[model samples]
Target: MTGVVSRAKGAPVELVEIVVPDPGPGEVVVDVAACGVCHTDLHYREGGINDEFPFLLGHEAAGTVAAVGEGVSTHAVGDRVVLNWRAVCGRCRACRRGEPQYCFATHNASRPMTLADGTPLSPALGIGAFAAKTLVAAGQATIIDTDALGGWWDPAVAGLLGCGVMAGLGAAVNTAPVRRGDTVAVIGCGGVGCAAIAGAVLAGARRVVAVDVDAGKLAWAQRLGASHTVDSSRLDEDGVVAAVQALTDGVGADVVIDAVGRPETWRQAFYARDLAGTVVLVGVPTPEMQLSVPLLDVFGRGGALKSSWYGDCLPERDFPALLELHTRGRLPLDAFVTERIALEEVEAAFATMARGDVLRSVVVLDGSGAGATS
Candidate 1:
């Protein structure tokens, strides 16, 4: 199969022929239909994550089950599925306690996907969906309703569930749990942030404030259900907090989500909420960045400052529910899709997404129709 490989740090990924192993025990091979380009892929290209060379990029993906290995009964050939990175082991301590998302013994493919020349390829987050096919544990293959008119979920929408939407929606509905008539604020109007805004609206938040430096994103944020928008242009911590407070009777929001993940935005999320309100950090920050709030503030805050990882999602529970919501038209998952391109166009899609002009650019396979699943 042909896959995107980043042979070296700071180098462009090459579409190289790779040898995908047939599913081993407990694994399955998926014929990928579409994959969405995410910021994490770019981070791998820039060597920000690690020095794992010859990395296979692309994770957020939907595909069809092409084959299953011995002992696998959870899925079969022709079943449509979404691939997830976290495949937890039932024996892990976290899993034993019913917290599989934090499972210490997550499972992955025991065998490696390699270059045709015989070198092993490191798949990004164990997903590496930017390819013709990929191998994953049966558990990683979450079966979803992909029959919205293609081999996979309509590429135009099902593909986003591979990552960003899961992260954003989970952050809001699962982590923050915005209640009816609650005032919510989401910092960073990017894909995840906008999704959070939409989640807030769907969760019954009465006032949803979208914050970002980009005017274009803020405009789209409005469409996604942000009741109000704040352009974080010359605004510091106090300025942003004051603005949010003003929108909510000077008590700030009931829930503040820092989707940007920088220290500054995190601090803003910390202070932009009313006392006892929740703060959810869904952003990805560099390892070197240190959080430096006063210890007294932590006690005074009186509520949780939680970190939402993949929106604390169990794909088995979330993906099917989200697909159902999409099929019902209650969740506008399609609004996150901005463009549709072929596998060869993945590089250009990254550029467009980086500018924040596009929410998500899906790589639609030939048979799949655009945007219908959403």
Candidate 2:
């Protein structure tokens, strides 16, 4: 099989012949249809995530089951599915408490996908799908109904539900639980931030304020249903807070989401919420980053500060429902698919993403071509 591999730190990824072994017990092999190029893959290539070299470099994917290993009865050949990084273990403490989204023991394929020389390659996020085929724990593949809306949906668009999109949408819908008539503000207008904005709108927020340094991204946020936008490029933290509050009747928003993951943006989110409002952090921060806030404010504000892990989503429940909403023309999932490129064009896609040129550059492994299909 052919897949993208990052062989060294900061080196460009290359398409290479690889070996994907047959699924082991409780695992399944998938014929990848489409995969989204995400920031996490770039982080792996830069060795920011870990020193795991020669990593298989894509995870956000949707595909069809090609084969199933022994003891895997949950799925079978030909099932349309979306790949998820978190495959919760049923016995984990979180799972026992009915909080599988926080399950401590997520499962992945025990065996590694190796290079042509038999060197073990770590699959990015444990379910590499940049290749024509990949192996993952059966639980990692959440089946989607291709038959929905009379089978007119595209898997390439559905693949976005696997990672970044899901995280952002879940952050607003699940973590903050944005309610009807509530005012919501989302910081950072990237793929995640735009999704958060959309989620707030779908959840019936009366006003959605999108804050971002990029004018293009802010426009994108507006298309995703934001009622207002704040260009944070020229604004200080206090200014951003003031702008958000002004949109919410000088009381701040009911929920403020920080999708930028920087100290400055976080502070803006903290102060851009109402006294009892919620602040949700869905962005990924570097390890060296530290946050400092006034202890008195923590008590005086009397609101919750939460961090979302994959939007605290359960794939089984969220993926299908969100897709259904998309099919019904309620959710703008198609807007996220900025362009489509072949699997080998991932390197170029990364550059495009870094330049803030597109929301998502998906790799259409099955050769369906890029862009959304109704």
Candidate 3:
């Protein structure tokens, strides 16, 4: 099968032939219908996540099970599913404690997909769904009942729940747990940030503020349910904080989420929340980034300062419920799809994402044109 491969750091990804072996024990092979181009994929290409070269890219995806390995009774061939990196091991400590979302032991295929030349390829986030077909642990496939939705469901849209979208929505709905009548502010209006805004609205936040340096992103955020916008392009850190506070009636938001993941934006989120309010950081930051906040302030803040890992989501529980909401027309999850491109155009999609011209450039594999915006 053909797959996108980043053979070296700072090198453009190439569409090359890959060898996807049949599923081993406790694994499955998925015929990918659609996959989303995420920043994490770019990070892998840039060696930001790690120096695991020859990385097989693309993770956010949905597809049909083409084959299942031995002992994989949880899913069967032809099952419609979304791919997730966090496949919880039911025997993990966190799972035993009833918090599988925090499962420290996740499952991935025991074998690696390799290059045509026999070099092992590390699948991004243990998924590597950029190919026409990919292998994953059976636990990584979360079945979605499309027939129950009562209509044609777009895999291009449903696949997004696998990663970025799930993280954003879960960040607000689960991590911060936005409450009714609460005011929320989300920094960075990218795909994940916009999803957080939608989650805040779903959680009944009285007002949702979207902060970004880009006008297009802010507009997208508005469409996703942000009641107010803070254009931080011309503002200083204090200005950004003041803007959020002004929109929240001179106090501050009850929940402030930093989706940019930079130390500066994190600091803004730190100071932009009302005293004793929650601040959730969902953005992925580089290892070199550091924060030096006053110890006194940390004590006086009196609220939670937490980092969300994949929105603290349990795939079996959250993916289907959110997909159902999307089917009901209550969640504008489809809006996140700015365009649908072919698998070969993934490198170009990365450029589009970097230009900030699109919220999500999804790669459609089924040739169905289910949710093509471009």
Candidate 1 backbone collisions, by pair? 156-371
lDDT of 1 at 225: 87
Error of 3 at 360 (Å): 0.4
lDDT of 1 by residue, 1-374 (tens): 77888898878788889999999999999988888889999899889888978899988888889999999988989888889988989897899998887878777888899999999988988888888799998988998755543322575577677788889998999998889999999999899999899889989999999999899999989999898988889888889988889988789899999999999999999899999999999999999899899999989879888999998889988888887777677888888878777878877887888777798887776556363533
lDDT of 1: 0.86
Error of 3 at 178 (Å): 0.3
lDDT of 3 by residue, 274-354 (tens): 999999999999999999889999999899999999999999999989988887778998999999999889999999999
Clashes of each: 1, 0, 0
TM-score of decoy 1: 0.96
Off by over 4 Å in 2: 369-374
- TM-score of each candidate structure, all chains considered together: 0.96, 0.98, 0.98
Error of 1 at 326 (Å): 1.2
The predicted structure with the larger lDDT, 1 or 2, is 2
